[model samples]
Target chain A: MSKEMTGAEMVIQALKDQGVDHLFGYPGGAVLPIYDALFQQNHIEHILVRHEQAALHSAEGYARSSGKVGVVLVTSGPGATNAVTGLADALMDSIPLVCISGQVATHLIGNDAFQECDTVGITRPCTKHNYLVRDINDLARILHEAFYVAQNGRPGPVVVDIPKDVQFAKGTYVGRENIEHKTYKPKLVGDNDKIQQAVEMISAAKRPIFYTGGGVINSGPAASRALRELARLTGVPVTSTLMGLGAFPAANSQWLGMLGMHGTYEANMTMHDCDVMVCIGARFDDRITGRLDAFSPGSKKIHIDIDPSSINKNVKVDLPIIGDCTKVLEALITTWKSQDRHIDRDALDAWWAQIGRWRARNSLAYRQVADVIKPQQAIERLYAATKDRDVYISTEVGQHQMWAAQFFRFEEPNRWMTSGGLGTMGYGLPAAIGAQIAHPDALCIDIAGEASIQMNIQEMATAIQFNLPVKVFILNNRYMGMVRQWQELLHGGRYSHSYSEALPDFVKLSEAYGGVGIRCEKPGDLDAAIQEMINVKRPVIFDCIVDQQENCFPMIPSGRAHNEMILGDMAIDLDAAISDEGKMLV
Target chain B: MSLAQEKTERHTLSVLVDNEPGVLARVIGLFSGRGYNIDSLTVSEVSQEGHLSRITIVTTGTPMVIEQIRNQLDRLVPVHRVRDLTVEAISLERELAMVKVRGTGEARSEALRLGEAFRARVIDATTESFVFEITGKSDKIDQFALLMQPLGLVEVSRTGTVAISRGPEAM
Candidate 1:
């Protein structure tokens, strides 16, 4: 049915039709009309965030946790500029986001009027697509199209900049049914010939590995199921990127933890030595493939990704399959079963034995301190307390993020949300808020660092305002631990400015923000404190003081090949000889 | 790129993009941000009904660098298609330039003589000065302009290169 409505009303109506239940936003003069329209409606719940950046990150959290296209509303100028970081983050990670920002009136856009800036100009490179809606009649269509483009092929963030004048004008409200475009249809099915080639490579391999990535999770739960099934049927060891962690069951015997800069010994070795590598849904980023020339030097690679540009852009593959991960996996399984092909059990057993020897290195080993808690120990306790429950994990960047990825075992997709590509600091708190809002009854926690957590600490107000029982687990290590670690190893131990001197007390800060706080300094009290934070039906910031000098290891120094990795088992003596180049102490 | 084959080659690329604000900026930003040199650039709306604009860029780079530029341009969302006219073997390229010559006596008469040889028409004339309008390939205009430079050439304004493939198929 056609209905005449104001531009603001049309936006709300379009969002309603598109099944957007929650919106994260911060109001300003340019977006006042949209806020007014929101005030009159009860169908869509509006979440007022403390900052525009937090709104986008929180929406990201909500999107990443629930597999929904997150929505955001902000005013023009600073409001839009504040969102640039989050937009870049979403773009690099392929997170689906629709950000609607209000611009100055159309007549005053060219003039230096109040809060007027070229928002579309600033955001063009950072967004998947963007629009500047001039006519009121086009507003509804543009809004719906924004949602479609954000959630469609190789999903990423899309922006719609609406001038204030359009918000006051009247327009016809056309829903999603009437807002289709002919130019942007993305192909979903992989080419059959290429799928056959990949299946053949998989069936004939000896040292085979399934190197999965975030694309599997983004392809939805079916892709993850297909991946587990493929691993079971093929008896292939699976190694995931940091973003691809939960796509394969972490608890499964075939799982090789994560493979990257700080990844486990077995995982990195497996990647280096695999003969037939099936890489699903992950880009070969520099972080994943350190010193690309020496990466998987002998592997016959099969890369399956939805985006065609990502194929052969970084590392060329023997066979590139462009399709959704779910559909491609289904095709591979069908072909493998129909051909009645099986991997030679003797050669596979040899590969498994080689992997077992690598796993025995215990690269993650660290000496325990009796008085102070180690960051790794903190994550271990956090996992032990929450392993049996339904939990969603989010993280800020640095050493703590690596610890969380290493220590926390995620058996399901869409349960772990972190800023992987951009590695934006202060992403965890607001993301946790968004996750908590989406799954209110589930346990959502932001595993954070003392230095990184302060970046978006203001979002604590939003959690209290909404009464979200989100837990903030801070591994308080006094320094920007990652930066300090690098400086110590790479720069002759000149700490520079990596330390935060006048840090605020988290217990006091949490109380000031009208939430509960707990500080666990001793290793013995870690589990009980975690239990308390979980049981408290309000936002709790658990400040677990940790060892400051500890560094994240399994380190491949910058520009070094993957095979030249330094394990942490003899880390203490290596730390003592700061300038020694790969000298052994064992 | 190898040290033995490091010589740069000039290539012209024709790109079709959405006709909207900031689309041009995005294209130029890609070039400038990557430190690639643009020798000549021109843009205009080619299809009003389709709301599509065409941009022609002349750049010099190695084969590997040229391929990188093409791949990066292809990655832009609003860019519908990009065709390398240099790589297509058969294509037509043209540019128009208006050259003004300020002189009296023999210099002015010599300018007219050169204009006739180059097929440049005298679009505007005075007793002491004349403006000649010439249209041809960029190299032809460059040669004609060089001849006019000694013949009392004052100022020259030239539209950048515009090209099209020599076939019925439209890009």
Candidate 2:
């Protein structure tokens, strides 16, 4: 049934077998043969991007929402290099991606010919696995292995670098009978002993809080409910990392917001206040614990992450569980027999009561006395408009990004995708295009910063070309808000060039790109703009120009403790202002 | 204006093929089937060559699918060796692309000044872009292309990249 074909043809055919619809990439020398072969295939559509970075992020967007492997193509040398950041981001966040790059002919490799680089070596650290195809016949197997590696183990990026000569070589397109992984295997089943120990720790603790991260999303809705049931049954408060926002209902009574710099004041404080912090899926990045020494000093840490390296990388853990969250939770629950009065009696209730007091007495306020629209309020409004619908929300980096992470909660897993670790700029727009392709029925949005959105504004053409429905809500503050906010607070307000003097009229730009453009300059026009975007069912860019001076508050300055927070409206010193606790932090 | 002005391009590649069952046999079968000539061929397992060896190959093609090889190789099984000798412009792509120009007369003198400004050179200059061998990044080649465009975009050749892990590391 299978005959001779080039590695290029086989790869394309394999992608076709997988039912891939759209691919994003740009061209170069070493990869010419593949392109030539690819020209004959019409089943898959390839979107040409301005930069390689955009290609990877776009693929990530496609994969995160669809639970499929997003594929990208780029030429050798610089093209492969540009995709590294996006690959690292996907690897850390566990998004499925398959990236392919061309190479110089194999003979002149180390001699450094026209467009050659050791791509497999370069991407090894970032990718779950990488394959360099010398033998054209092995092309089908390599792709199959790459996809299997990317989608199976914790879901990450995989690279397949083919040489120009190899691509043109005649190869047989015998499909991979099945995937066989050797090096990287993410364990989905937990050990009985470890599971029992985790449960015992949970049951014995006086004050316990479930601290989670993006891993919960990969666990899907079923496991999430299981974790929530465990929390509900035990009456423990729950919190999340920035990536873990939608893992649980944001409005639940025991919910204690996200934990990090710009984390909810109570969540960050709770991490410190609790006697036991059961961290799940999140590696305690520096942003989460500003000063590790002061981070949960009084707490006994139980760090549970699928990654063995992350087990004790950031925050030291007394009890470490290394495996997939769903598997681990299932094992723990199986070993855990339901108990009635196993609660630490008054100790647990008192902890919960204190968190309640923090909310009742000092509800982390971001409201302005003069009625200026707060970023949090904007997020709240977006969430209210969507109404727990299955929507894909992609965000650009900085303050607006943090705010969206802080609020605008979703219910489904893989519904939210952002550049979590690498913070690649110009990620939002292209990613939205990819997301729209994966989830045509659900609303797809890019919550963008003015600076970050411009990074991939050209992708508007890709959206228009495909007639994909992608709504872009530009949180236009006319500044690099996150960097600017840091300058305002930590650097004594010494202004930098974060101010953009030649900011484009985004609405006009969107219109120029063959999409509907909606501008919301005031709160009154917000709903109409959102409605217009939803109704269009095509790409729409909404320029929501907000106050230029606002900052994302409840910030834990770098190298500071959770308790040391600079709340919003810090121009008026909280020391001089009345404190509900009747004590000044200063 | 002239066909000669377009210059010539050469490419080298290293392929990582799987040394398993009939994987390499099938891949070699593909190459011979298509009648594509490989300039050079080298195979050794960078990671357990007995089980998974890499095959380094060299061949030349027009700009058309210089981008397609790796895309194709990535689809192969056991074929682990496929890296572009030229993948700089996209990754840290630049600071890795070297400019080689040839020149003479006013063209050569002007090329030197311009190359110096862009931090380029006369690594081998007879009379063109000075064979102005400027090695820095992929962007440098683009800048060199522009500068040479006026000074005579003459004959240009570039070595894609010989990049390694940034830290004291190897990949």
Candidate 3:
């Protein structure tokens, strides 16, 4: 038996049933009824944001930090259009979210009504899945299904578009237990034969490396623990992608820093020369596998992932185990123990010697100057000051982002959140806000670049309103650092519009939003500024002015193999020397 | 095969998707948005419980472009499976075409003779015209339409290629 209620009431009740305590949204004409229903209820709290786009990003920050499915509500037309970037961002990063958009009435659809657009059509590609509910009877079930699909499988964003008429109409409220999804069960346990094959390869290989990614964190804390135990038991060096940092402890001796375009020297060299590569949860993205033909050329690969299509989509593996990361890692551990798998000790010692030679390069080494603060040093000092506290870190894209990933050490899962796949610039502030909201007592900081922080600077108001102390540590270089570096290297020094002109002083900007601001321009003031920012009881912005012309290095130029990396000290000076062909390119 | 022969080949692809609203539009949008050409398209509910639909599309492209299309289709979350029926297995493909022709005297008799020869049935008829429903491979329908052009062919409407694997395996 089901009780009759208005669609708006059903929406509120469903959220309550799903254990959702908070939602981020902005009210509009189309969602007025739902907003009215929200007004009469106190069970699910709603956080009003300045813009709909910020609402979705706040939800993303909340979801990525708390490991919960974030929810948002917005109106149709521009409200829904504004969320396209966040939806695509969440989709690319596999962040689970259920975004509910209120559309125009069913009769007004396709009729060019005011405040109406093709919400379902526009969001279809961006969202993992979406629905347009036409009948009132289908409203309750669609909302429940939206959560089911968004949180299950490889997690991603899902949208449910509700019309204005449906909000006013009556519907039967069905609980979650009554809803059923057919033909959508994902395989959670891997094949036993495939696991056995992986164990055999692991026991025999001389130079073995473990490459892990965000999927381990997505699989939960158990997988992260298993990954650490496996690396210790096998005595194999481990490397990770940008999204996989917190999934394995950075302090562990077997850790080879990050592996990719901006990866450390030892990590990239090991990936290029390994005999057996065990990829646990990370896809072989282009950044990780530089030139396809030369990527891990001599390795027998083993890949474990939940998505079947992701298995052989880019790099083919000799053995494919399709299952959750924790389940598969547990099975591998069991199989190895039961078979008494062992490797040649003498061969393993030689492999470590070779790795030690690569480590001697000290790929992250940079000259520290007395006058100006280097971006790398700023992140290093920030890490040194916050290393002992319960902290969550988020970053905006560019050189500062890479430096943050290189310098900051993460020792636990789900503690670091950044825009990895899409590389969205304005991700850090709101993500910090969301993380701070989830864990009010923890120190949450966004390691941001000067230019990227301005993209979503309006979110400072949200933090101030909520009284959440999220530190925004901006590496102020006064230019789009990554773009300038690319222009210098690839465009023959004809710098485009990468420099930020007429930029407002961040100190004044923070005060304008009623928040604390601190500026540190010299190397001597760096540590004290970070400490001051951390001690502030309100929202604070720490602007650390750094070297403007410095470039991020250990970079494998586009379409080049990993071994052909250009170190920072070896980077060519574009201004001092120009080839005869450089004139033409300019 | 020679490189020239492999440059562009007509291939039939079968895609299984969730039976939900706007899914077909999403599939068709991928083709038009990317500027990829679609020669023919047919869609119908394939599951008896009414939760899944099969969309068969016939497009011509190089091997690389076809592979990209399949990968992109698979990336869509609602899409359950995508199979290149032409390359994956030996399969039978058929198209249904209704051809209308207006003729008189000897032309009319010749039209009837050709229709019988091709095993086409006259679904509608008048004294001077007949609408023949023909079902066969795409090339066969193309040949029949070409033959009817000389006998005063008026119009033609064709359902795109629908295909399935020949063996016991279900894709």
Give the candidate number with the greatest DockQ: 1
**How do all the candidates rank in terms of lDDT, highest first?**
1, 3, 2
lDDT tens per residue, model 2, A139-257: 88788777777776467888888888888888777665654655445556766777777777888888788998888777666668777777777788888887777777876788888
lDDT of 3 by residue, B1-171 (tens): 222355887888999998888889989988886666799999999996858999999998877567767866776767888999999989889999999999999999999999999999999999999999999999999999999999999999999899988989998
lDDT of each: 0.89, 0.73, 0.88
- Tens-digit per-residue lDDT, A1-586, candidate 1: 5699999998899889989999999999999999999999999999989999999999999998888999999999999999999999999889999999999999998898989899988898789888999999889888988998898778899999999999999978887898786456666899989988988898889999998999998899999999998889899999999998899998999998998889988998899999999999999887788766788899999999888767776676899898899999998888888887788899999999999999888878887989989999999999999999999999999999999999999999999999999999999999999999999999999999998889999999999999999999999989999989877876678899999799999999999999999999999899899999999999999999999998897876665567767887653544444334332210
Q: What is the interface RMSD of each candidate, in Å?
A: 3.3, 16.6, 5.1
CAPRI quality band, candidate 3: acceptable
Q: Just chain B of model 2: what TM-score?
A: 0.45
Which pairs of residues collide in candidate 1? none
Order of quality (TM-score): 1, 3, 2
Candidate 2 recovers what fraction of true contacts? 0.00
> Residue-wise lDDT of candidate 2 within B1-171, one digit each (tens)?
222233335455555555654455444544554354555454544566356665544555543233344433443434443556545322222332345545568876776788889776556645234566667755566777887776666556654433332344222
Instruction: Name the runs in model 3 displaced over 4 angstroms.
Output: A571-586, B1-18, B30-39, B46-52, B58-90, B100-115, B122-131, B145-155, B165-171
TM-score of 1: 0.93
| TM-score: model 2, chain A | 0.92
Question: Lowest summed lDDT over 10 consecutive residues: which window, candidate 1 chain A?
Answer: A577-586
Clash count, one per candidate = 0, 101, 0
Can you give the lDDT of residue A2 in candidate 3? Answer: 77
